[model samples]
Target chain A: MRNRLKELRAERGWSQQDLAERLEVSRQSVNAIETGKYDPSLPLAFRIAEVFAMRIEEIFLKG
Target chain B: MAAYNLAFRRYIRRFVPLTIAYGASVALATAVIPDGAPASPGIIAIAVLPGLAVVGWLWAMARLLVELDDEYLRMLEVRKFLVATGTTLALTSIWGILELFTPAMPKLPVFFVFPLWCLGLAVGAVFNRLRFGAARCA
Candidate 1:
């Protein structure tokens, strides 16, 4: 799975740590998702979507 | 300004005292057992205490997996255990075969296996940090 997390986070003018703080996760988690090293679970995907004020499909795509 | 994780904090609080107790139990057992009367029930009770603590540690780890709430942290933990498990099993198999073939090799005590697994956890921590940039596993 690939995600637009970095782009979305960049758009918000927030660092990975800032996004992690908003999602209540470690900065490494955000970084992993951004770098395509890890995929988020459904609950976490939903949380990420909610954080960015976008739908999950808009943020993540199957690759 | 991300604060320290509260769950990890609580885990440390719970583990430290248990770890201390485990050390104390082993110390007392070692102090008492070298006198050629190591088979008595009192010595046995003291020695058994640390194993019980080991079991508790296993239980605590499982509980941590359930209660951590952070998905990425959970994934990191699961990956670590997988790495540890594979490493330990490989080591044990190799050592067992080596011991069978070599007369110079001393037999390891069965009780040492848990501590060996813990060492695997340490190795896994290193793997996690190197591969995923977690910095620390424990």
Candidate 2:
């Protein structure tokens, strides 16, 4: 579950903490997603896409 | 959606330390009590009550932890509680059975049981949290 979360976050000058707040998750969760150590649930993935105004496929790459 | 939700951060900050504190207090109490001592109903009550309080605290904390909007987080917490309950029951049953078979295996003082129980609960929480949070570094 690779994602463009980091890239998008960086573009907005948002730290993982910033992204996690928006997603209503712990910062660690955000870090986990960025590092691919955790795969976000579908709704969370959708939320991320929604935040970035992109399609889910554009943010997440299935392995 | 926007980026760190205050509620989630507050949840973690509040509960993680509570779990750790409960565990440390229980462990300390367990270690302080002598294993061989006279047992009585009163002593057992003393040993069990504080541990029971810690459980209550953990339960209360769990409620707060799940107050956020993440269903996944809520699910993980519920699973942790279930695991803790099952493990505690199994451990207690085994200890009781063991006592019936051999009374000489360093009979833990009745007064110490509460602290030990609390300690067990605390340790259980720590393990659950670690398992859940470990991937954060990955």
Candidate 3:
């Protein structure tokens, strides 16, 4: 899956660590998800959506 | 992140003592039980200590898996364990076949399997780093 996590984070002036803190995950996980090396689980995706105040589809896109 | 850190610290606490116990048990067992010694209950009990220590190490690892909260990190750890298991099994099978076919092949001790699995874990960590871009999550 592809995602706009990096772009969204950039827009919000949030670092990976900041996003990870909000999501209750490690910075490495945030980096991995942003780089498309890993796809977050449904619950984690939901958390990411909540963090950005956006829908999951808006943050994550089909590849 | 706090959960992961706590779990990791717990793992270290368990691992350090278990390592010392493993070494002490091995040394004590070897010193007490000489080669060609008769099988006695005392000797058997002494010999079992090392195996028990190994079991403790395994238990520590399992506990770490259970306690870790980050799903991605946990998944990476599980993948590493699977890779280690696969490597250990494949190598042992190949060695067993070689021993069966080749009379010159040296017998591989069963105790070495644990160490072999450890080496496999290192290989798996490297594989994870290369493939997943992160090996040590903690």
Best-fitting candidate, measured by TM-score? 3
Relative to the true structure, how large is the alpha-carbon lDDT of every model?
0.83, 0.66, 0.89
TM-score per candidate:
0.90, 0.57, 0.96
Runs in model 3 lying further than 4 Å from the true structure: none
| Interface C-alpha root-mean-square deviation of candidate 3 | 0.7
Candidate 1's interface RMSD, please? 2.2
Per-prediction backbone clash count: 0, 6, 0
Better of 1 and 3 by TM-score: 3
Interface RMSD of each: 2.2, 4.4, 0.7
TM-score of chain B of each: 0.87, 0.50, 0.93
lDDT of 2 by residue, B21-123 (tens): 6666566657755677557665565566556656766665565555545544555555555555666667767777787798775565565454454455555
TM-score of chain B of 1: 0.87
Alpha-carbon DockQ of candidate 3? 0.76
lDDT (tens digit, per residue) of candidate 1 on B1-138: 233376667667778887887888888887878867847888788878998888777777777777777778877788888888898889888888889999888887777787788889888889988888777475
| Residues A1-63, model 3: lDDT tens digits | 999999999999999999988888888889899999999989999999999999999989998
